[model samples]
Target: MITNLIKTFIELFGDSNEEICTFFAPGRVNLIGEHTDYNGGHVLPCALEIGTYALVRKTANPFIRFYSKNFPETGIITVSYDDLSYQEQHGWANYPKGIIAAFQQLCPIETGLDILYYGTIPNGAGLSSSASIELVTAVMLNELFAQHIDMLELVKMSQKVENEYVGVNCGIMDQFAVGMGKRNHAMLLNCQTLEYRYLPVSMNDCSIVIANTNKKRGLADSAYNERRAACEAALAKLQKHINIASLGDLTSEQLEEYKHLLSPLEQKRARHAVTENERTLEAAAALEKGDLARFGELMKQSHISLRDDYEVTGTELDTLVEAAWKHEGTIGARMTGAGFGGCTVNIVKDESIPSFIEQVGKEYAGKIGYEASFYVVKIGDGAREIAEAKEMSV
Candidate 1:
């Protein structure tokens, strides 16, 4: 695939003498924690083997030219470094442009480049494709400009691009997982403190299967911001009655005691944040002890909280998860990303994967009247430049 991408880049930009380098950043799937990132809570997420790839070469021009094999209709979208503001007409190009604008704040970007991106992650699947783009661009620039910035700082800068430039009120989970992911491990992140530790993913007989609902969700235009705003308001009300910094700071018992301080909607939102944070911590403990059954139970409870308290999962997500629960070999299943409609992360026994996919796909189609896609993915490393041989395997 890298060979073909290189050929395409050369064909479009002419045979330039500059050396071309390739980079990769993987997409992420949250295992248990949902709608808790911006609430200053804990989250569990892992990077997938499938993500966005970039083939780039430096140029003397003052403008950056962007192309994507995923969206051929857009062709090559060029942007001058002077004008990096968001533009609706630019479509997907805004993501990369946002990162460039962010990097310009740290160092001077004097020369431009030609970049070709090919992503395996499905668009609107809520797998952090946008963050994948942001991190990949940030890593590429870090290499090109020889800016020896710390990886954690790059993660923060990528989150800034999402919040300030892309206009999404997202938390640090996605960017952090994309930038700091380790192979065969899931990160336990404290969003408020930015402290994290990787827990080994040692499901010896189980595999991680991602099932895409095929229902498109636009995050910037979705109710994601409204939920964040609701949580913020709830935290403010709780502060007046108690001494706490965020929803994550409160326990379930404390939240029940102070539940009257917030409105009905605020109470539910706060409850989800507080309880979900606790569940994430417990889930991590369960995994640490190699108790898959306990982890699966926590995962089921997490989905119920997200569906009832958070009110983010719609019919599609609920249907898929409910279907998965019917399978006896299923260990756990839940909507992975910021709900509405996206994919679900499930742990199924190796021998049951085939039957799980067939039955789940049939049930989903019968109810939702459309086919869903499934992929058995392995946990992968974080963003970086890919070597030629490694690129072939990726």
Candidate 2:
């Protein structure tokens, strides 16, 4: 894939071999936590082996050119550094454009760039593809221009690009996991405080299988913002009676005690946030204790909360999880993202992955009238340039 991308880059724009640089940024999957980041709750997310790649070179002109293999119909998008505003016609390039716009605020980009992007992540599958692209752009710029921005600062800038530029109110978990991921490990992040620690992921005989429902979701167009609003309203109601900054600050018991303060919908939203936060912490501990069963049970509980309280899991996602539950080799399965429709992260015995995929895929297609995709992914390192490799061969 790297060689092909490099070849494509040369084909698109005449390349100066020495000036070319390659970078990768991985997509993230939240193991347990869902819709908890903006609520100031905990999230356990790990970077997937699949993500976005960029082959870029500095250009003499102020005009930036972009291309993506995944969206060939869009052709090459050209924009000037002076005009980095979002352009609907540019399609997915807006993600990188948003990052460029945000980065320019901190420091001037004296030179324009020609970039070729290719992503392995399934777009709109609740994997952090947008964030993956954003971080890749940030890291590419940081390396190419010698901008010595800290990684954490770059993570924040990526989030800012999504929130302020792209107009999607996202939390730091996606960007943080993509930027700071370590191999074979998951990050336990405090969304409110930004305090995090890496927990080793010892799946042993089990594998992390991501099953895509193939139901695309546009976060901004979905009920994602509404959910955030509901949580905010619930927090406001709780604040009237108790002193708490966010839903994360309260224990499950505390939330139950104050349940009467909020409307029924708001109460359910708050309960998911509070309980999911607690579950995330416990899940981390369970992993540390090498208790996969406990962790799997927490994953099941998370799906129920998301379905009943959060209401993000629709029929497609529920079908996949339900099918997974009926499989004997499956340890746990749950919708991993903001939910309306995306992928479910499942822990299954390595030997049973084939049967698990066949059975689940059959069940899902039978119910949904469409096929779903499955990937057995590995935990990988964060975004960085490839110094030794000339091309990326996915």
Candidate 3:
């Protein structure tokens, strides 16, 4: 894959002799936390080996040329280093453009370059493909130009690009996981304080399975913003009765005491954020104690809260989770990501993976009238330049 990608890059830019560097940023899957990041809650996410890769090299020209193997139709997007402003016509390229525009404000860009991109993650599958692209761009520029930016700062810059430039109002979990992930580990991140620690993921007998529902949902246009608004409104109502900064700051007991202060809709929204935050902490403890069963149970509860209180899980995501739950080999199953129509993260015994896939796929296809995709992924390190280009996959 690296050979092919490099060959294509050379063919496109026609600069075989010039120095080219390979940079990668992995997509992330939240193990338990959902819709809790923006509410100042904790999130458990791990980076996957499969993500976006970029082949970049400096150019003498004044304009930067961008090309993607994934979206060949977009052709080459040219932008001047002087003007990195967001352009609607840029489409997917806007993600990288946003990062460059934001990053250039802090660091002085020296020259233009030609970049070719390729991604293994399924687009619109809620795997943080956009975040992967953003981080990869940030890392690439940092390495090529020696920007000396901290990893956490790069994560923040990526989130800023998403929220301010892309207009997504997203939280920092995606970029944090993508930028700071470590191999064979999962990060427990406090979205409020930006404090985090790495927890060892020792699943010797089980595999992490991601099942995509194939129902496309765009975060910016979806009810994501509305849900954030609801949580904010709920927090405001609770603030009148009790002093709290965010929903995550409230405990389940405290929310119950002030439950009457919020409307029914606001009550539900607040419940998910608070409860989900607690569940994430419990899930981390379970993993640390090597208690997969307890961790799985927390995952199931997280899905239920997302379905009932959060209302982000649609029929497609629910169907996948329900089917996975019925499987005897399944330890726990839950809808991951922003919910509407994404993927479910499941823990399945190594021996039962084949049967689990066949059975779950059949049930999902029969009910949803479409086949869902599955990938057995392994936790991988965060964004960095490959010392030597290599093939990437699960």
Listed per candidate, the RMSD to the true structure in angstroms reads 1.8, 1.7, 2.3
lDDT of 2 by residue, 70-178 (tens): 9989998999887899888787999999998887887899887889999999989999999999999999989887889999999999998899888899889999999
Q: How close is candidate 2 to the true structure, as a TM-score?
A: 0.98
Question: Lowest summed lDDT over 10 consecutive residues: which window, candidate 3?
Answer: 385-394
Tens digits of per-residue lDDT for model 1, 11-122: 8887866788899999999988888889989999999899999988889999999999999999999999889999998989899999998889889898889999999998
- Give the per-residue lDDT of model 3 (tens digit) for 32-130: 889889999999999999999999978778888999988999999999987778788998999999988887888767777899999999989999999
Model 1 CA lDDT for position 11: 86
Distance from true location, Cα of 203 in model 3, Å: 0.9
Stretches of candidate 3 exceeding 4 Å from the true structure: 390-394
What is the model-wide C-alpha lDDT for candidate 2?
0.92
Candidate 2 runs further than 4 Å off: 390-394
The positional error of residue 218 in candidate 1, measured at the CA in angstroms, is 0.2
TM-score of candidate 1 to 2 decimals = 0.98
Clashes of each: 0, 3, 0
Question: lDDT per prediction?
Answer: 0.92, 0.92, 0.92
